[model samples]
Target: MYERLDKLRAEVERCKRKVEDDRQRLKAAEQKLQEAENTQILADVGALNLSPEQLADFLKLVANGQVGSAGTVSTVTAVNKETEVETKDDDDYDLEGLEDEEN
Candidate 1:
């Protein structure tokens, strides 16, 4: 009986660890999905003016904390300027309103 009890306890602990690991994996997946969605939204809004190479370089610098406040500000300003230039004189499609009307 004691041996059976010990085996059951070990199984329960193993199940608990599995549950925790699954939870962590789910959280990581959700974070990745959010990042992908944000990237898509930026692309749709014509706000992502940086090329893949530029984006990779910027992300590396930011991740390493090598980008100080001034650097951060300048990067943001440059992106905004590019986006403005790209979107200048563009008419709003108002897709949201069109969807609402269709509904």
Candidate 2:
């Protein structure tokens, strides 16, 4: 009877520890899921490239159903800036130390 009682107590303790571990893993997974969702939302918002005031106004207009047709929504133009090209050539170095071997 004592042996059976000891086995039951050990099993309960093991189950408790397992449950705690599972809870921690679950919490981490939930945090990762939330972060991923936030990343997706930020990516979508970033793609819009709207300033804070413009985004807020656009969102408010959309929420209020103010923009009904294509004419009502203002046109947003994307500005393209000229970027400077990197002209550093790493493979063009002159090797001055090596002597030519005559075979």
Q: What TM-score goes with each of the models?
A: 0.45, 0.58
* Alpha-carbon RMSD to native, per candidate: 10.9, 15.5
User: What lDDT does each candidate get?
Assistant: 0.64, 0.66
Q: Show the lowest summed lDDT stretch of 10 residues, model 2.
A: 79-88
- Count of clashing pairs, candidate 1: 0
User: Candidate 2's residue-wise lDDT over 1-103, tens digit each?
Assistant: 5999999999999999999999999999999999999999999989977776666766676677654454443333322243221222234455454434422
lDDT tens digits by residue: candidate 1, 1-103:
5999999999999999999999999999999999999999778545655766556655666677655554223222124323421121113334687779989
